[model samples]
Target: MALAGWICLAGHLCWMTLQCRSVSGKVLEETYTKWLKYKDDCLRQIQQDPQPAVGLYCNRSFDLYACWPDALPGTTVNISCPSYLPWVQTVQHGVARRRCGVDGQWVQYSEGELWRDISECEEDQETHTEELWMKQVMLSFRVLYTVGYILSLLSLLAALIILLSIRKLHCMRNHIHANLFLSLILRAVAVLLKDSLLDQHWSKPINTHADVQHILSHRAAIGCRTAQALMQYFVLANHYWFFGEAIYLHSILITSVFLDNSKCLPYFLLGWGTPLMFVIPWVVMKLLRENKECWAINENMYYWWIIRVPILFVSLVNFLIFMKILKVILSKLRADNKQRYPDYKLRLAKATLTLIPLFGVHEMVFIFATDEQTSGIVRLIKVFVAVFLNSFQGFLVAVLYCYSNKEVKAELQKCLRGWWRWMQTCWEDQ
Candidate 1:
């Protein structure tokens, strides 16, 4: 039954496909649809050669019967820009100014020149320079994000192995860490795959934004959509596990009413199961929405925010619980008898540093304001800060909870000694 359930879940996830309806998409559809109809007519005529002609030769003097390039009567040919340049627009993103006259033939460049497209998209020096600078800065951020996450993954794996290997390290607290670490690993993988999907699309040069859209429409668009959903899922799972971290502390220090490990039950349920409520609605809405995007990144941004509310609530509740736990610890600490609980205060402090940065609740600072409105140096700075903070989350957690923990440090030292003694014995035997 468990295996059957897993198969059903996989089938459901694999069935979704994305469709987009951007303004650029509409222009592309019209441009190609016109040409395709003309090609079909030319092929059927079979006058001499069967292939459709690019354009017909016409005299400079207007001739009443002069044959022109195949086009609708009284309609100008609309040429869309290449996908790499920008978009098919009059002002921004790259636009073209080639038109076929009433003769159904393409207009010439001049008396003796071939037609040349009037370039406007990033045509100005300032706009082109700004775009180049933005691309370079984004490239740097991608490098930092990828390298940092990979390093964090390696560190988290090493910490988990050490925690599980030592009998002394196996505790409820470490269990929470294990779950959070796993969530981090999964989220990082999903984000990497999402970026990889975009790389595959834009890697090769395509003639128009329409071509890029068409390629994505027919290709593995579902893969990109699935990556996005999984990223959302695992990111939330990581935050909820942080909530579990706070809950664990709350149980240990404030609420002594629960039996040993009973608190873990609620943590497990919330960490794994609560996301289903958010993800289900987002998925169903995406599948049913009229938009073309395989994912829910639409103009109104409703689909994206559906999951955001839950994350905000979780982070807020966790923060409150964490503060209460800290208050309880301070209240329990007697001033004159402070030496009695020296290690207790240290544990509280470590937990504070560990949970806050690990889950990135402190990132609430920039959550409301992305760099969409800003430009120039301000946008670059915002991008840098966001990337730097998010990239180092797993690193901070692993360093604080595993590397800095006294028990883990002592266990690691013992492990090195064992390995050293084994090496020495092997040398003697040789």
Candidate 2:
């Protein structure tokens, strides 16, 4: 029953793909058709070839990716690089190799997989240089974000510990901060897990004997898709939690009388439950329309917008609330600063700094911007800035709301002093 349902779903997706009217959808359909034609030609060639008459000869076959021919045991067969792939232009003169083992079967790349060694197909010097440079850039970006997230994760964990452990710090604001910290921690973890599951080097398909119809199945591993979905959920939660923080602050400033009885339940729901509204539909869209390769590539803008639009909307709302809060704060500061202007200035500066992270107003700069539309140094700079902002945001928030908060600092100091006195007293008694 389950298999039948999956077949029906797959048939529906194929029907949708064929009937798609968008230019990108048409291109995708054309590419798929071209691959099917190529596979048919390979299979035809394999069928027309004379069958092996005796022992010690590997059979002719098509491995869904490339065609293999009958060969003597222990001999390697070489074929021209396939022309169907986009990268084939660079490797026009290149060859793909596959080995036949002494046991009269195609030699396995691993215990259960057969492979064509396509390394030679990527040996063009000029193309290799370009790819190498791009790979180095990617490696640098990955390393930078990985380190930043690890630091942020560790810092946020410590902040959560402090906030949860210290009873004196228990308040609505601190509780909200703890939720924000937890969301950021989960986002970092999701990002790391998604990266690990879908990294190009690790997730690249192992060529094996399989039908062309199942090629996408090999590429789109369930684990990577699940990771991608989890990443989306956590990322949305992180943004909406920023929205929740803004709402919390706005309420405290604008509706102070209601604060004592306000519950964290609503904020929790906003932070965690709301992402499902966007992510579930986005996942369904990907599965039905653009199901390929870890759900990372944005093939259809409309489907991509399903997730991007909500994040932008939340950020914009947060920004507006932040501006209103700032205005109210400045007005109050002016009215209250008749006697102590310097202290007022300091307090205002602290408030601005503190609210910036809580509201996540920094995202306003590049919220509508994308790196893909740029080139050269502009693209590099945009990517770097985006990564730096995204990766270090939790760390900055933790520092502002927990590590550097005067209230938290005072509590830590008081705790340290008591522990020190206890140690001294025990020493004297001993």
Highest TM-score, which number?
2
Instruction: Enumerate residue pairs that collide in model 2.
Output: none
lDDT, candidates in the order shown:
0.61, 0.76
lDDT leader? 2
Q: Candidate 2 residues 1-430, lDDT tens each?
A: 2132123323333333222213223333344566568779998898887777767798887665566788999999998876554456677888889888899888775556675677766536786476557657866887899998999999999999999988999998898899999999999999999777655323233232132234346354588789889999999999998988888888878764322327888888888999999999999999899886567667678888889898999999989899989899988998888756757778888899888889888888767776446777777778888888889998999998899889999998898899999999999999
Alpha-carbon RMSD of each model: 10.9, 9.4
- At residue 174, what lDDT does model 1 achieve? 85
The runs of at least 3 residues in candidate 1 whose Cα sits more than 4 Å from the true structure, single-residue gaps closed, are 1-113, 117-122, 205-213, 256-260, 263-265, 290-296, 330-352, 370-382, 426-430
Provide the clashing-pair count of each candidate structure. 12, 0
Listed in order, each prediction's TM-score against the native is 0.70, 0.73
Residue 182 in candidate 1 has what lDDT? 83
